[model samples]
Target: MKLHAGSNILLNLLVAVAVSLVVNFSYLLLLLVDQKNDPAPPPPPEEVLRKAERLQCGALHVSPDGHGYLLYSGGDSIYVPMQRIRRLGLRDGDSLVAEVSVTHVPLAHPVMGKVLRRNGAEFDYGSLFKRPAESVVLTLQLIYYVLISFILLSILTPVRFRYSRRRFIVRCVWCLVAAAGLYFVALVTEWRTGRLVFNFMTPRMLDYVLLLKCSFAVVVSMLYGWVYVLIMQQQAVAMENEQLKNEYLTTRYNMLVGQINPHFFFNSLNSLSMLVREKHHDKALTYIDQLSYTFRYIIQNGQNTLIPLGEELDFIQAYGYLFKIRYADKLFFDVDVPEEFRTWLLPALSLQPLVGNAVKHNAITTVRPLHIAIRVRDGYLEVANPKAPKLETEPSTGIGLENLRSRVHLITGREIVVVDTDTEFIVRVPLQNPAL
Candidate 1:
């Protein structure tokens, strides 16, 4: 329920107004009743009793002619209208007390002003009725309710830079707490425009009108909070799902690009032919075995997310053999990794791209042999080789190294660092400690 700008303001404002209207529904009904039944001077008091607006008490008596009277107020009866008797459901024996006014009419009796009580219990006029339901008074009430609701929603719904589980829990707790507090405040003050201190302690605890207004306030506030939390949680989950879908897609793409594509397949065969031409049968047999193992390793491990460093290095040994046999003394692998780092895991085939890039981009010769070092340094698997740029070389697309970098990050949430200087090209890939 985070509020955004423009259209969101109008939507939230409407939500606030709706909550206010519902919460004050009973009070609004009372307003409408008052507007329809505005009490008029009751048939000119039959006998002027006292000044207007004085309290009068007597027994209620309604006649068949649609007229009613409160008998025995200071030995004189007061005129009560039939509509008031019907609204209050008054009976002949019922004791009633109300404000009375004197009107200049002969023998009509003093007219009732406002009903204050029936029997022993007090009546809440504020709850039962309010005048001017559709007048400027009602408009003021509407404005008051709208303001309260708008502010409440503006505070309740907040914009957050990022979603957080802990913060969400805290906010929900606060919402219920605020609702509980607002319940008491609403009881003490009027929810509508009658009065802020309207009818306090007038209605008994189980009064239906009182219960309706209070319950609506509490329940609607609680419901608003519940709906807000539900929407926010759902949005967060949807965003997370979308992000994972993209990551899954990227990982699949990297795996496809990682497959060995016969880059050195024909080169190995040419080296093997030279060995057989020189009549070195044993060496050629060993070369075929190593070449077979390299291809098998690539195909088998391509689907895997991660493998032990030792397992990857074993495959590299088979892979490096073909290159070593081709270069002979011009290229050499200086392996210096310890056995302790062998169990650490990294992405499968992570090192192959680095090795391929070293050979593809640099020139190796008898004058300055390509001494590629594979070692563990500061928790990283470091592969370093002295730069020997060929005088005339094709431009490198750098796709292989970029592919490895993306794969490693996708699997381990880590980055691969590459430093290419005048003398050496160093690539350091992070290693994850295997879970015990």
Candidate 2:
């Protein structure tokens, strides 16, 4: 029922950083208005040609009074306004190539007009101001949007108790609100002119950059919301599938414990009954002990998923003794397992089916004794026995072996390797590596 990863600090941080990288903020210029502070636009060609007659090229001189004058080679100079000087941060001894116009003042030099070039570089009045570089602007913008995104995510997390259309719509609306709020930010930080100046008289027009940022914000919100929901939903599905598989395994294990093979039970009973009738008192009591142990082991372990390899081996030894009594000197088992690997885990009752299959299909006699070997190799528990064909082969649906294989797959997500040859048959069951 867990829904949202909003509490995941790492995921939230990553989303904020990604949004910052994707969002573009430099386009704020086209969204908000700014004061008409930059120099006027260039005149038409005919007006420029007429103005060129009075255009002069000279070195700039700043007087003590903060006024500017362009000094030519012939010592002639023209007056430059103080306001323009302050705006462009004009200094003394600059190469000022400028245009001029006459004034109606008494004996005043012609007033300096728009600057054509400064130090051989053409610059508009706004461009003359030392504005921040594009990278610098982008970086500041990234930081700003990163903070915004984090705050938004914290307030209306993508996933909370559960997904709701109202909540999703609210998140979308919040993104738009955040985006619209950028207009105020642009008002303060004029893109083309002064940055962070807080001028309200600036003019704004249709800008693709502002449109782009708004669109990106809304889209990011939608995408993040859906992705988070999808991830949570997927995890929920996996958990349900695991639960269903466990239920199926439970049913199978119940059958394993509740239903013993009818033929084997009757045969064991007949053998015990015969021993009792023959007055083999000690043998009969020992057979009953072994039979009880075998049933107890199966019932105890049937519902379990896995047990230590050593424990199953103990169970197997007891189980094998039951058959040894029935076919004395005709069936033998050689179990060779290292102590270090005894603690490794295997599916419960895994060996039961394999042992049953071998005994069922194979012939056992005083001459051709069936030898079942249990050993561990390469992190696998291998049970191998020589193929002994009986005079009459037993009818088998193979459901026992197939069920064991399916159970292993369900519990451990692994497959059992079965090898069948003319001379021998082997089943290799993978074990869980033991912990230190």
CA RMSD per model (angstroms): 13.5, 8.4
CA lDDT scores, all candidates in order: 0.72, 0.75
For 32-129, candidate 1 gives per-residue lDDT tens digits of 89878988644323222254437766787778887887887466788888887777667777877678788888976788877766675666665564
Q: Candidate 2: how large is its RMSD?
A: 8.4
* Top-lDDT structure, candidate number: 2
Clashing pairs in 2: 33-202, 33-203, 33-204, 34-202, 34-203, 35-202
**Tens digit of per-residue lDDT, candidate 2, span 1-436:** 4544655556667788888777753344422323335557765434654666777777889989999888886788888889988877778998867778888889877988877777766756645665665556666777766776665655456444455567667766776687566534542356666554432344654456655665675567567766665676677689889899878777876665344455347656887888888898888899899888877776687767788999999988877887787788899898999998899999888887788789889999998999999999888999999998999997898877877787788778899999999999999999998683
**Model 2 poorest 10 in a row by lDDT:** 25-34
